[model samples]
Every structure is written in C-alpha cells, then in structure tokens.
Target: MSSTNERMFTRRDFFKFSGAFGAAAGLAVAVSACAPADTNSSAGQASTGADASALNEDGTITAAISYELGTNGYDPMVTSAALTVAANWHTLEGLTEIDAATGETYAALASSMPTANGTTAEVQLREGAKFHDGTDVTAEDVVFSFQRVLDPANNSLYASFIPFITDVTAKDDRTVEFTLAHEVGVFADRLAVVKIVPKAAVEADPDAFSANPVGTGPYRMTENGANKTIRFERFDDYTGPRPARAAKMEWQIIPDPSTRTNALQSKTVQAIDSVPYLSIDQLKATDTVESVQGFGLLFAMFNNEAGNPFADVRNRQAFLYAIDMGKVIQTGLSDQATPATSFLHEEHPNYKRAANVYSFDQARARELFAETGLTKMRLLCTDHDWVRKCTPLIQESLVAAGIEVEFTEKKSADVYNTIDGVPGAYDVVIAPGDPSVFGTDPDLLMRWWYAADTWTDTRMHWKGTAEYEQLQTILAEGLEATDSATQEQKWGEAFDLISEAVPLYPLFHRKTPTAWDGTTLVDFKPISVTGLTFVGVGSTK
Candidate 1:
C-alpha cells in the first residue's frame, strides 16, 4: 500500500472557507460610546521622577501573567506552560529563535545557521557565550541538550517535533554536528526546540537545575517561588543579540483575567496577558488593547481507540458536520476568529484547501450517525471562557443531528488527564491548541499533534492501525524529500489523508487579545499568543 502521503483525496463539493483575522473585516471595534482612557491621568501618564528613577535606576518592572510560576519547572524540555515557555525565551538559547509575531527565524546561541547536506548539519557556537552560573557554553553542552530530548526516557514533549534527528556530536569545543535520520526542509526552525543547557549543571542536580535554570541567555532566574511569582535578574555579563532593557522583571501569576486586567487598570502591573475577550472594549477605553492574528485553535479531538464510536470515520465526520461554525464564531468566539479548513490556514504560503470541508449539514450528519448505530455520546470540554459557552451549542448541534449529547465541563488540564488515562472514557474533546506556540513551520505543526508515539499513540489512541502507520511512513518520506516542491506536495498529501482520517481537526483560530499600560511601558507590544514578552522593553512612565 502507498504511504498516507501518497493517498489521493477526491475533492467533495463544499464551500470554500475563507476569512482573515479581524483587521480587514472591520471587527476591530473597542467601545465607540466610551472614549479611551485620559492620556493625562496619573495612571495613564508616562513615567517621571520617582517612577522613572525606579525603572532606569532600579531597573525593575512587574507584569501580571495568567499562568503560575514553576508550572512545569524551569526545565525547557518538560515545561509546556505558556509562561514558562515565554520565560525560557529570556533564560534559554536555542541555535535559532523564532519571532512570535512574524514567524521569522534569527540566530540566538549559534553564531549562524548550520551548513547542511542531505543527512548532516554543522554549527559553530558563539566565541564567548557564558551560562548564568559563569560557565562557558561549549559544543558538549549542545550535544547533551539535543540528546537529552531525543532519549525516549526523557519523554520530552518536543522530542517528536525533531524526529529527523538521529545523532548529535561535538566535533570541537565550539563546533557541533547534527546527523539527521532524514533531510528536514525546516531543520533550522526545528532547532528552536532544543534550547541549549549546561550538561554539568543538569547532571549534578537535575531537580535543583530545574528549580534554578542556568543558561546563556539575557536573563537569569533570581527566584522561582511555587504558584506565587518568578523573578528574573538581567545577566549583565551576557553577550548576545537580544539584551534585557530592564534590569529585573517580576512575573506575577494572576490567573484570573479580571484581576490581571484590574492590575493593569490600577497601574499595579505595567502589562498583563490573556485579557478577557469580553473586557477588550472596557480595557481599550482606558488601556491599550491589541488583538493580533493568531493560529490558536479550538481542536475537536476524538478518542479513536477500539469500542469508541468515534473510532469510526463516519461518526468523526458526523460530529464535524453538525457544528455550525458560523454561530460558534459569532457567539463563542468573536469575529476576530477565522474558521479553519485545514491545519494550514488561508494565510499560510503552502495552504491547500482541505478535502471534505465540513459545512453545517444536519441531514448529512444524521446519515453518518445512522451508520454508526449509535445515537448518543458524552462530550468532554474545557472550562475555558469561549469553550464553555461553545459546548452547549455543540451539544445542541448534535441533538439537532439526531444524536443525544451529554457534556461534562472541567478544567482543560483535568479534561486532558481523563482522556490520557483510559481508552473508551472520552467521546470528544474541545480544547485550545496552537502549533505556532512552538514553531511556525507546517511540518512542526502537523508533527506536534499527529506524529507517532505522540498525540495519536497516547491520547487519541489510533496506534497500530494501517492509517496510523501510513501517516508515520508519509511523515518520514516528507522529511526525507530534499526539494521544496516535492516536500510541500508530500506534506499536502499527508494533510489530505489526515482530513480523511479525522483523528482530530481544528475548528477555528481565535485572535488573542492582550491589554497593557502603554503609558508606563516602552517597546511593549501585545502578542497574539499566551505569554508576554518583555525583552528590550522597559518602563516609560
């Protein structure tokens, strides 16, 4: 049988899903009736005298964050928390770094990108990169870091993203070579996953190292208190491209959106992350709120293991067919969101419209449900703001399609824990995920949720199936293809197969809204994803 990448998909008669994120659609309204916050208000005024001295002289800035400190520890490989990931941007250094907004790649720890042949790539470390503990970063550290992730025992969340890597070697004190199992088109971008760490530090006391991470980046962890706050002191001796403009930063873990917003309103925090969508207008009337284009998706995942009705393709297709995406966008998500046709969005360079584009067809959904010989399901959903609102609507759609629906709401983490525990427990999962949170490349995006021994093998439970094996083989082939044209075609082929298989698919990409005290912050811009960036930013007030 041909690999999943070689599968031919017949284009079904379907509506072309098309839309940009907010900007062109005139959905950028804040509050028309309420004017913006007074520019001259003390809270709105730029820093002067004592405030200016505190920033410039004392060099400290406190920001309100939605995620808790030491959520998954300071370990780059283990931590999947957004705040930890963002914090790592200051403390850790990968060979290449991806800009969260532009999806552009730039050199971080490595002086330049690795020179690559088909199966091998070589890199040279910067002349004087030093860890926060005053230890020199060497080629040995680079090899150890990559190998640590590659080891199956480590069970690194990002290890699956770099499956092409076969071996990493330290050729010299400053030189390292990466031997790949196959040629990856976006190898440089993939390197962003492996944030270089000192081997000695990690080996000596892994737990302590995770508590107090030491890296060659612009910032060093001064304090990492559990659930309270994380403090980063600028590494004055650091020599790197991106330097900390502020000498010290305090990341306050304020998970409540209202509290975070209030902190910004009272000028208690110079900035805040995860501004509630409903509060955007209110925050904008007083503070600065920026909603950027994002790939953050509400994933509708199915448990594809045996005995689950969702294991059948018809049931999976039926579930999607029932959802009225239009209503979901208007009600659950604002017009700031874009409905997803495939893993690749309309704006993506290599995007090909997915086959079997599920339009709202209750009749078609009923037909698919009849084939399942099942009329009911227990839908498990996240307790996220919009997700909670969207669940009842989803349940209603299922009922309209002649299927009885029952739903249980829980925290996103608890929902995942349940799904990850048993085989036939969950029927469906509606949760948020963003591939761009790791890397922007389509390969990384697909591999993150679809790769073997990853999501499919673990949570979704589609392992040992012909379809799953085919996907694995196809991914390997796609990675091996040297030419861009062939590589893209191969990837596109895999995407088509995935659409047909339908283990899990994205419903839509929602724009992330963030509010900041613009008057107090310099070079502080709201980002589309979770986690606020403070590099090269300081207090202006």
Candidate 2:
C-alpha cells in the first residue's frame, strides 16, 4: 500500500470540491436580456405572460452566503462556491436523481436504467428541453458535459466520478452512449449532480462565460461579479413545471454573522445562509425571521504525516477522549449540532450510529498520554468566528485531561492551502465533510481516509493498517452489489472496524442555522447541503 505521506492528489481531496462538483464543465453563454424585437412572437415575449414587466411584480428575495464568489474566476473547474451558485442556473437530467421522499436514487433524465453491458451505457434526453440561449438541448450536449469533466488537463474536481468511463458518444440527437473502463454502480447518481453547460457558449469566450453562464434551469444569471450581489431572474422559457412563485433572486456576500443578522432584523436581506450558532437563539426569538437547521458535518481532522504526534494511534485516541463532545455541542454549537458517532449522518440511509467511542474520560486520556509520552501540541484551525468559538472549547477540554493545548488560527484560504501542500502544519484541524446525498458507499469514505495522495485524507497518514485495507475492500464490493441487505451488512462491518480504530474521532454534525424573513419570502425550503433554492422561492407582499 502507498504511504499516506505521498503527495499525490486522491479522491478525498475531491471532497472540498464536491460541494461545487459538476458545475465546472460547461461554458457560459451571454444571454440577451433585452426584450426580443418581435413583440408578439419572440421567445421571451411568448414565454413571459402578457404583462412582461410584472413577471415578478410581487417582490424579490435576497440571500447572504458566507464566502466571496468569483475570486476563482467563476470557473467550476477551480471554484467550488461558484459551482454551487451556478447549479441553480443549469440542469443535467441524469440516469438517477435523489428521491426527495426516501433519499434513494431514481431515474430523472434517462428513460430507463442502463443495461449491464460492461462496455456501454445508454440514455435518452428529455424532449423539448432548451438552454437559456434558446438552443435545443440534446443528448450530444449531455455527452459533451460528462466527457469535459473527465478531461485530464481540465483538472475538474470531480474527475474521479467518471474515471471509469473511457468514452461518451452521441448515439443520435436524443440518444447518447457511454463506454466504461470498468463495471461501476452509482454512475447515474453521480451524473445527476453534474450540471450540463452549453458547448457553443463556452467555446465563445471561456473567461466571459463564467460570469454570464446560460443553462436550461428555472433561473438565469442576470448580473454577477466579485463582492457584488449575484442576481438571478426567472427563465421565462423554462420547460419544467412552472415554479410556484415568480421572483428575482439575489445572493449577497456577507462574511460577518452580526452584520448578516442586523440585515435580517432590519429587513435589508430576505434570508441568510449560515446564521452563526451563537446568534440562533436571538434570531429565533425575532418575529421577523425564522431559523432552520442545515445538514452538514462539523468535526476535527487530525493530520498524521511524519513528525506529527497524531501519527500515533494512542495519541489520536487520547485527544478524542479528552474532548467533551456534549459541552462542545451545547456551548460552542448552540444546540444546533448533534454529537457525531460516525462519518455518516443520522439522517442518511444505512447509517449505523456508533456508541460514544471516546466519551470525555480525563483519567483514560491521562493514562494514554503517559503511555504515549507525548507533549503539548498546537491544534490548527481557521479564524472563522465559529471555529474560533469551537476550538477554545476543545482546548479547555483537552487541558483538563492533562494535555497542554496551543492554537494557530489562520485565514480560511491559508489554512486549506497549507494543509493541502504541507503535511504537518498542526496536530489537528477543525474541518467539515459534506457527503453528496448519502449512500453506503465506502469509495468516498475510504478514499477520504486511505487514498495515498489526497490532501483531505489525513487519517491515512497515520492509521493505515491491514484491517483498514480489508474494510475498504468490503466497502467497495458492497457498494457495487445490487442487493441492499448485503450492502448494508458490508457497510456495518466497515463502520464497526473504523469505530474501533478511531482514526477519525467523530466530533459533531452541524445543523446550519439560517434565518429568513417569512413575511417577504414565500416557499422557502432549506436543503441539506446547499442552503436556499431560488427556484421555488418568491417574494410575498
């Protein structure tokens, strides 16, 4: 097995980009926003009800996201946050999509499941679908989108998803073919998340395309730039079910939670994406706003490369035992989080919640420290407000357990860049993993922990063992197995082995607290991974 210290990029490194996965493939097309010349029969005029100016006459919804957009050129290939924002503008009907009801995969873009022909997968394009540029969407576009992500030079973050596919060819205008390098399951689910971009539009001007992306989705990017508000207008020509409400959507970048809360209270912004946990109670009490929990993990990741104390299993386990998870969840997290027992979230299907592995036992932690003979270590984390609040709580807990704790907080970019390039920056860092619609797939989990070259697979640096290898094999095979029971059993086995080893001390899963003005915004549903969807949201009175 390759040593975890190897500086190769692996699937685990892809997790950071998973939040914005698939948005990187297509080119942006300049959409003509001006009303068409032919007043009676123009595409825009025909789609917009007789009263075109009053399309969204009710009101507009404004949102605040934590990060700044367009810093990475709005290219999905390099920018994750931009990819997420772009997802609202494009559509890729995949062979399977997450069933909103059961969170299971179901057919969406494809008419039926691909046959088990090791070489080829077939898909039929949905009829009458047209890009925002008024170009008809065909199977050719879908084939091109998938192939683009797999391009080695493009360095698309989600390249691993389709690494097994050798070719994507258009069988006909409405039909496409995929030739696989190997037999793989979950292919459709992976494709479902990929947003298809227009080939002609991207080829026109790749740089300009990022800002003016065009897609067949319900909304279109009307205006966008760095630090400036991103505006999305409803696509009048959208072929899907008409959205419940018509409204213009705006995403304003606001880094400070206090400022965001003030905007919410003052009715300046209709909704805020990540309401700081500290402000949840205050927001909940306000009659003008409603707070909702977001689905994501909040945990500490230990780097176990050479010279790092976390390289020792005993030390890692000791750190876990020293931390008081309950208090951290209550005080640091504002009851919006639950003590995490495993990598998988409780809401996920096939999730086997493990019992507390390292329940706050200062005595055991001290004993482990003595056995390991480790000294004081610095825990590295970002200087973000939440991390700042959480890390100190962890420091206090560890200190009580006879461990001297030091901290080094840097900007978010510096933290990710340093950890990605340099192996041993600090012993442990606070991190979060957002799984794309959970399933019992070890490919992502094992890849995250054991993949030799991944920046995010810090555990692999220290805890690579024969047992870990065996569990990974079991997980890989189970995900490919068609039988649900066998898959569950295999997942259970892997979960048990991982919990026993405690390579990653499950800290807590965060419930993203978001506050939205209910009176102004209508039909708002806070999703699990991404925050607000502008598709069904609209302004009230």
Candidate 3:
C-alpha cells in the first residue's frame, strides 16, 4: 500500500480508549451572548494580555488541566491515558510526528521521509539526536521500540494500530527498515503511534522508565504529577525542528472544572484545558477559549455476553433510543457536542451517517424494552469531570422510558476495572473516548472499539459472534483496499453493521474547549483532544 505522511490529522494522533480525557472538533466556537473581541480564537493569532507581569520572563508556561492521570504510566508503547500521551508528545518522538496544534505530521527522529510503495521501507534517523538522558538515538532503539509494541506478550494497546507491520529491522547504525505483513498506505504517518524510546533505559528498569521515560524530543518530563502537578524542562541540546520554546513547563492536575477555570482566571496558570461549557463565556472575557471539534465521543457500550439482557441487539437499541440525546447535548453539554450520526462525528472527513440513527423515540424504546422484557438494568458510568455532566440525564432518560436504572458512577479506572474481563457487571456503560487522539483514519477509529482485543474479548464481550465476525471481515477489507473509494465504502458498510449490532456505539462526538492566555504564551493553540500541549509555545513571563 502506498502510504501518505499524515497521521492524526494525516495519521499522528493516538491513545485509543474511552477513558478520562479532555481533548478536539468542529468550531463549537464558544461565542456567548456577550462575547469579547479578544476571545475569538478563530482570528488565527495569539490573544495578548494587558498584564505584562502575568507573563513569564523565566520562559515558563504553566497550565491547569482537568484530566486526571489515569492508572497507566508514560510508556508510549502501552500508555493510553490522555494525560500521559499528551506529555509524551513533547518528551518523545516517532520517526514521524503529528503537529499537536496543526494536526500535520512531519519527520521528527527521521531526518527525512523516503519514498516507498511495497512492503519494504527504510527510515534514516536524524544525525546527533540525543535522548534527554544524554544518550545518542540509534536505529537499534527504533527497532526495539517497534518490536516491543509488536510483542504479543506485552499486549500493548497500540499493537492494534499497526497489524500490517510484520517486523522492523535496523539496516545500519542509523538506518531502519520496515517489513510489512501487507502493503498499507498509512504506514508512514502511522509511525507516530509508536514513540521511540531508549531500549537500554527501558530494559534496564521498565518500571522507572514508565515513571519517567527518556526520549529524543525537545522536553524531558520531571514530575508526573500523580496527585499534584506535572513538570517538564527544556532539553537544551535538542536538535529537532521544533525545540522547546520555553525553559520549563508546569501543568497543575486540577480535575475540578470550577477550580481549573478559577486557576486560569486568577492567573495562577496561563492556560487551562477542558474548560467547562458553562464557564466558557465568562472566561472568554480574559482568555482565548476555542472549542475545536474532533472525534472525541461519549459512548454507550453494552455487555453483549450470552444471558446478559443487552446481549439482545433490540435491548441495546432500546436503551440508546431511550436516551434523549438532544436534551443531553443541549443541557448537559451546553450544546458543546454534536449528536453522533456515526461512530465518527459528522464533521470528520471520513464520516457517513450510519444506516440506523437512534434519534429520541420514547415509544419505540418502550416497544423494544417490552419485546425484550428488559425491565431493570445496571448502568455503569465514570466520574470524569465532563462525563459527570451527562450521566444523570442519561439515567433519567432510561428511567423515563420505564426501565429501572441501577446507576453506579466511579472514576474512569474503577469503571473499567469493574467491567474489563468481568462479564455482565453492567448492562450498559456511559463514558468518554477519543481515539482520534491516536489518528483520523476510519480503520484506526473503528478498530479501537470493534477489533482491539481487550474491547472485543473482555469489555463488550462481542467477539466470537457471527456479527462480530462480519464486522471484523468488513474492517479487514477496509484496511486491505488499495483505493480510497473502495476502502471508504467498506468502512460505511461497517458503520451500517455496527448501527444494527448496537453492542457498543457513540451517543455524541464532543467539542474540546481549551483556554490559554495568548499574550503570556505565544503561538500556543488548543488541540481538539483531551490533554494540553505547549510544544512550540514560549512564555512572556
């Protein structure tokens, strides 16, 4: 397959999970009724501040983030948490990279991208690229990195992203070659998903390495901010195209929406991500808040194991139809999210409305419930700051449809622990996910929930069924198709099958609102994913 260099926007975004994250999308441009001129982030320039002292002269850019550090650590090979992946963006490098702000992929560890169409492709590492630990980057490190992710015993979540690659071999000290299982057009940009790490450091102490990995990127992580704050310092010897524009970076892990907004307002931090929809208008008075729409979604996943009430597709459809998605979006999300028409948001370049859309139909919902005799069902939900806003309304809608909802809300990790591998723990789960944080391709997005081993075999228990086999077949065809049109058609068929299957699906694709003081932090743009990035940003303070 002839691959293009685009990853997330083209192919670079990654972290495929329905977990606690604040990340992307359509310009849900937060233009409150009384908006200020400076708040228009679409103006395409940094928003300047009047308080010169608030700017940092020490070249430090501080931010308040609403996402909690998930149970996982910062191993790019295994870490799927939004917070850690965002940190890895600055502290790690792929042979190619996705520009956080622009969604464009460019070579980072690789000096330049070579042209190749067949199974074999060679990558040349940039000369003199050094890890934060002062070790030189080598082709061997790149090979080791890919090998670990491909190792089945490791069971890296990213292994699903590049099933096409059979092996990665170092041709020389600085040159590596990729041997593909098959031809893939996205081979180049998909390289961003596996961030290169120092093999010596990782193999020496995998635990310590996960705690604070050493990489070839512009910044090195100092504090992981388990309960307090995360910190980074510039790698002065960095010789990459986008060096750290600041001397230091600090991210206050404030998961409370109100507290995060207050921190940004009080100037305790120069920027904040996952800005509450209700707080956007007021904060816009002082900061630049842009709600970019990405593929981030609030999903409804059903336990489809045998004997589970939701094992019946009709019950799953009934539950989805019962939820008044319109009110949920308008009131719970403050109209900051779009009701999902497909797995992908409508704005997604590859989106096609699923054949069956569960628009609010209380009567139809009741009809299906009566047919399936699903009177009482347990609902599992996560307490992620933003997800909290909608779960109550979801419960009410289900109750309104005459089904008893035994609602249980926990932190993202707890919710997954309750359901992962344990069948029938809950009939349905309402949570957040943004696989687009991984990339924008339909294959990557669909495989995240449908084809990935953990989600298919454990969480939803949809594997081994005829429908599951059919969906998998369609997905494989989509990935195998050489032409774009045929691939998209196959993907559309997968969406149609998923719509009817209803094992797990999206309720809506959300907008990510991020607040940053442009005057204090120069050239910093909000991404449509869950974490905050300050890659090319410089602080006036």
In the range 1-541, model 2's lDDT, one tens digit per residue, is 1122312212323333322421121111101111112211121111211233333555666777554432344444444442344344333234444432123455445556555476577877666777777888778777767777777677565564445577888989888888876666667666654567677876776655555555666666665533245666666666554342554667765667788788888877877766787776788776233322222555566766656777677888888888888898888877767676665556444578664455778888899988989868878766555656788888888888777778777655556656665666677876544443322244544443443334335333543556556765776666566667776777777777766666554577565555666555655544443244444455663
TM, every model: 0.87, 0.78, 0.90
lDDT against the true structure, each candidate = 0.71, 0.56, 0.77
Model 2 clash pairs are 8-453, 27-202, 294-512
> RMSD, each candidate, Å?
12.0, 10.7, 7.6
- Residues 206-315, candidate 1, lDDT per residue (tens digit)? 76677667788888877654425677788877887888877788888776778888898988887787677778899888887776655566778898998888989999
Pick the winner on TM-score between candidates 1 and 3.
3
Estimate the lDDT of model 2.
Answer: 0.56
**Alpha-carbon runs more than 4 Å astray in model 3:** 1-58
User: Candidate 3: lDDT of 480?
Assistant: 79
Candidate 3 lDDT over 79-160, as tens digits, reads 7766777788888899887665555668888898644468889989998998877888899999999999999999887888
Best by TM-score: 3
Positional deviation of 369 in candidate 2, in angstroms? 2.2
Over 4 Å off, model 2: 1-58, 70-73, 82-120, 152-155, 162-166, 180-185, 241-244, 285-295, 437-453, 456-468, 501-505
